[model samples]
Target chain A: MIEFLNSIQNSLIYKNFFLVLSGLDNTILLLLISLPVGFVLALLFALGRVSKIALLSRTIASYIFVIRGTPLLVQIYLIYFGLGSVKFIRESFLWYALKEPFWCGVIALTINTVAYGAEIFRGGIQSIEKSQVESGLSLGFGKFLLLRKIILPIALRKVLPSYGNELILMVKATSLVSLTTYMEMTGIARKIMAKTFAPVEAFIAAGILYLFLNFLMVQFVKYLEWKYNPHLRLNN
Target chain B: MFKFDKLVFGDAGWGDEFLIATLMTLLVSILSMGLGLFLAIITVWAKLIQNKITRFIANFYTTVIRGVPELLVIYLIFFGGNAVVMSIAKVFGYNKYIELNALTIATIAIAVISATYSSEVLRASYLTISKGQIEAARALGMNKFSIFFKVISPQVIRHALPGIGNVWQITLKDTSLISVTGLVEIMRQSRISSNVEHSPLTFLITAAILYLCLTTISSRVFKTLELNYSKGFST
Candidate 1:
């Protein structure tokens, strides 16, 4: 075991593994920024879908459908190359953000996650029993008060598991930003592969880093689930 | 300034190329989903077994595969897979670079990822099958295999179809990643065309449309199956 550790330490890929792991800084940044922005956008989309106005609801529904049906890779490329190719966009204030791979990735991911997150939110809100709403109203709860006190809390708890799944999916999805030439986890692996021609070693190291990150995220989400939903506890 | 004529099928058009790539995407997605279903059955079986070692192995497989990104898995299979095969062959005195076509690697990689999710779905469906039903099948002198096939499997399929449909949608989108492996799928074809034509928006929008078509058609098919299976019973 000591010899194996020494061998690994002596290898070029292992020596450079920390440099490659540094690419996950962008991955972490993407997650932190996109999740909250996506969540707010998702709330709007979900509300629009469930709103009384037919035009607003239909427009949001179609937008969700388009976003949901497409792949995130295509979406990223479209925003990066497609929008970046436009003359007006290049000249516009948005050029600074759209031209950079990092912001482009964040935008594309946020848009894609909004579609999915909205659907999950809509499902959770809809799943609430009608009697619950009626009871809240009978207790003289106003629309805003009812949404704040009864609806959002229950809906949030119900959607936590699926939302957690979406968060994990977003983390995985950030790997694609490497293709945009951003030095994320997968990007660094590609760089090492290009230099060392040791795709196996470099990719294994990268995969381990990703697995560790995801494991931590999953455990954190599990802790949140435990804390939020006491009714799900086993005889506690 | 967009040229609609270039999108038409002809000597001066990319319509034929797009159509061919669309077919390739469909073929890969269908093949992966089929293979994934087979793997899911085995995985769910392993998970269900009442053995400590088997359960641990199953958990490790699903957790690691699910935790990592699909792109890394594909790259690992494409690179590490060949190295493993070559090293194994070396013991037999056959030393050569064993090359796997992108289609095979992509199919296997996507199937492996899909199987993890599908196994979870299948396990959940299996759990929903009442224990009394299995006991009753045994009470009728049914063999284990017969009970599984004739009694339990159909209901499991009925319960698992929607979940399987969701997995298929994911698989369909995931085949785009195979473009990195040089597969001539829709995404790759669009990339080539856009690079050549200098019309990234046009080709990508076309690819997105092709994807929307595939998803729309498959969702319809799944809905039909769901209706057919639940014909007599009301949800």
Candidate 2:
């Protein structure tokens, strides 16, 4: 039985499975670093969309539209090869950060997800009943303070489910990091397939990893929604 | 700044190549979207069926397809499909290897992903039809097919227009990933031009402009459809 198990473990399928699994760290890192960065930017963009200044709101809306309309792959390529080729960018202080493929991947993923997450957040903010805002204003809360103390808390809860989908999308978008030569899960799978010519097995393993990660994210978001919305739970 | 002349029609320009690639992207996306709609109809039917196993399988299909990265799905279908076909051929006493066209593989991959989203949208649209309406149609002795055509489909299309528009936008962008499989779509053509010209920024930006155009036009078309469908309804 030990010999039989050893033979199974020593097979190419098992070897490639574990090899692809080893790259999960890069994938996780991309998701963790980009998501928080994206969340901050998304909140800002969402706020900008609803700002009193027409120019700021219009500019932010156009930024959201352009980003949404283009492909993430094109954006990734534009940041990496396109920006990297510019002599001005090379000489600038930003080059130190932009020179690396990992950072490029993070920047692309964060910016793309911000476009999506911002829209969701804007919807959440807009969905707040007008009467609630008026009551807060009548209670002597300043606009910024009202947003900080009252509006955001409620809006964030409303945005959780949609934001969860955006989170999953970012996780998927990270797979495109391979195009920039960064070794994430999909990158590792591609390498394994190239060397062994067994793309089926390699990609299947990678797909399973992605599916598992997304499942966890979905569950976590659901838990947050449940915990945050006590009123709905009590009513039920 | 790059020379604008290089983008114009000439032997030194990529205008013709870029135009061809744009058409390729449109063709592949349209075909896949049609396939996705067909698949979604079947998936929705399976989900709405009164059997536990079918529902479970349908649920599993959508969850897995939607949850996984589309690039991985593309890779899986391209390579895994070849393997599966080769193995099946071997079992049939055929020794030759089989090669599937990258475009077909890409269309199937994108269609599978699009179908999951389409199914969810279609299912939601179907649910919006009042149950009483269906029962009333049945009470009038209308068959399932007649009830679906006369009652359900029009409303579903009206309700599903926006969601389907969202799906089309996603599908259009996703055709970019098919470039990895060597389809000479806009993204792939742009990459080639960029590499040859050593001006990655210019080519990529141009590609982005073309993509933006495609999406903007389609969104307008979908808006028209939505307006036409919601004609009598108040805003």
Candidate 3:
């Protein structure tokens, strides 16, 4: 225990908080870009999954199955290393996107999250009664108007709890972006550890930062839940 | 673009190594699952004890571990574990440098992460057991051990099986992340084979297929267990 304390006192994590904080931008950037894109794609795929067309639903089902079945690390490696190794891909105009590890990490993270997020969205959408859609049509609401005014708003609210869980998971998952050699918080912690030989302190520093980030997120989700469900609040 | 012959056994191909590596991955995963369950039982016990400090500690373990990225946990164990272990060893009057094997390190790191999740499953399962059932068991003059063995455990196992199955799948997939510690698990082995064969696409897709099979098969197995345990009872 004393060793743990002494190591903390002697380490760079305590003395260099700003250096550790520097990696926060990359971590937040990855989340900001991927989460919205993933949610949008997830909603589209979830719609496809529930569509009347068998082929479209079946295709989306298989895609989600394969993506959810495999590890995100393998998916990341597949995008970063596997796709990059193909000769034509390397030589083609697509290399601009594939060459950067940050983009590769983003692509993999988005793909993986979309699969899980799609399932949540599907559940939320499915919970809505078919009567609601029919009623909207009877009232002369156009398809897109109905979606924007009713379907999306209700579905998004229904999925907020699960979406919050996914948000936390994704925040934690951004740490894996370090595997592609991207300088996220975890990657920065690794670099700092390598330089100072203080692995425990560096990791603790990173862990604390993630905990703080998720704490804020959880509170925001809680506030949203409270705001949107005033009837439930009144009952309590 | 495809070559099945490269997966042939013996020194002529990397197939044999891949098989062994797959087994290694399974071995680590199964070991970590068992260890995680043990820790989870203790964590749940601590929570149930109703002592403020113990409950707080248990909550801290689950919340902090779950919040942090798992890769960070593995990295801390891979590097910091050696020094911590050496220091404890020194207290036991050993002077030689003691390095933790990659297998042990991987198992411990993954087990710590797995325990936090499994504990949540288990605690909920325990909570699902009705308070009346325990009182009824006591009213029957059943001993504590007998009541726990007969009334509590059967219900807990049945309720918790599906959740544990999810945790088991997560643990299995999390093993691939430990490949960063230079363990010759399926992921690391795939990297080696891909580099040697210069066909990353083929090898990685093979790895993905292997994972898909493992997940599907194990999920089926969990389904069977759930069914059998649920046999004679209806909800």
Candidate 4:
């Protein structure tokens, strides 16, 4: 059994197992860049969706509709290749940033997640009881203050579970960054598989990494959920 | 203003290729949705009526499929499908290289993803059916299969149509990912055109617009289905 284990470990394919460990950096970087940007955009788009003004609401609706309707792969291709084709963008100061696959991927992922997150937030906002808004008004709160103190907090708390799912999705979606030439986990896995001809081991490793990230995200979201749930805390 | 001239039938434009690709996209999406719906029915039935083992199997299927990214699922199927098929064939003493077509691969991938959503919808619809109604049917001497078709199935379809429509749209959008496997769907065709013409913006924009068109038409159809299904149930 010890000899068998040594043989498994000594396989030429397993020699570079540590290379996959370095891939976690790219994975973490992609998540760190995309998540906060996605959150801000989601907030703006959600506000636009629930805005009183017809034009603001309609424009946001169209943006959300179009983005949600299309596949993220097409969006990535369009931003990376399509936007890159424009002479203005090519010549602009932003060209340097756009040239990097990392930034390009972050841009695509941020846009896709914003669209989904906005919808989730909008649903949460819509589901908020009108009596709460009335109470906020009775407390002499203006629209902005009410949104800040009451509406936004409740909406965000309510939407946290779904947003947690979205976060996990973004972790997995970062695999597509490989298409843009960013050597994230899946990208590295593909390379390793190509060299060693062991697709199952490489892919299985990548899948485990993804599952691990998702498991962490689930735990983090659960902590946030517990922290925010006043009723549960009061009982405890 | 957008002009139809570029979209008109001619060799100079993408009109013919786009049309053909759109058809292919629809074909793939419909085939996948049909397969998913069939799988979902069995899964829902298994989860609802079968033993604990069957229920566990059904739950495991849904949980794994839903938890993973659709892209990963597609990749797994794309790479592994042919090998698995060939191995199965070899066991039967048929060792010739049987090429799994791109459409079949895409259909299976998308169907596997769609089945999770479809099964969820079916299970929800099943739960929404009143238990008393089933008991009444049984009391009236209706067998399980007979009662299921005559009562439960129609109502479930009616209730599940909107959810199913959402799944269809999702499947439609996901077909764009099949380009990775070299399928000549709209997205793939557009990518080819973009590369050849060096006009990525125009081609990608056109592709996005075509997708919007498909989704908008589908939303309308789903709305009509919802209305039609609600006619008798609502005042």
Mind giving the per-residue lDDT tens digits that candidate 4 earns over B1-235?
2334556678878889999999999999999999999999989888987599999999888877776667667777887778889999999999999989999999999999899889999899989999999999999999989998998998898989989998899899989888878999999998898788778888888889889999999999999989998897867
Candidate that beats the other on lDDT, 2 or 4, i.e. the better one: 2
**What DockQ do you compute for every candidate structure?**
0.79, 0.88, 0.80, 0.51
Task: Give the poorly placed runs of model 3, Cα more than 4 Å off.
Answer: A1-11, A130-142
Question: How does residue B208 of candidate 4 score in lDDT?
Answer: 94
Candidate 4 is graded, for docking, as medium
The DockQ-based CAPRI class assigned to model 3 is: medium
Interface RMSD of 4: 2.4
- What's candidate 1's i-RMS value? 1.0
**TM-score of every candidate relative to the true structure:** 0.96, 0.96, 0.94, 0.93
- DockQ measured for candidate 2: 0.88
Ranking by DockQ: 2, 3, 1, 4
Output the worst ten-in-a-row residue range by lDDT, candidate 2 chain A.
A8-17
lDDT for position B161 in model 2: 93
lDDT over C-alpha atoms for residue B204 of model 4: 85
lDDT, candidate 3, at A127 = 94
Tens digits of per-residue lDDT for model 3 on B1-235? 5568788999888789988998998999999999999999999999999699999999999999999999999998999999999999999999899998999999999999999999999999999999999999999999999998999989999999999999999999999999899999889999989888898888888889888888989999999999999998857
Model 1 / residue A194 / CA error / Å: 1.1
lDDT of 3 by residue, A91-206 (tens): 99989999998999889989989999999999998999889989999999998998888788889888999999999999988988898899989998999888888889888888
Taken in order, the candidates have interface RMSDs of: 1.0, 0.8, 0.9, 2.4
What DockQ does candidate 3 have relative to the true complex? Answer: 0.80
Span of 10 residues, lowest total lDDT, candidate 3 chain B: B1-10
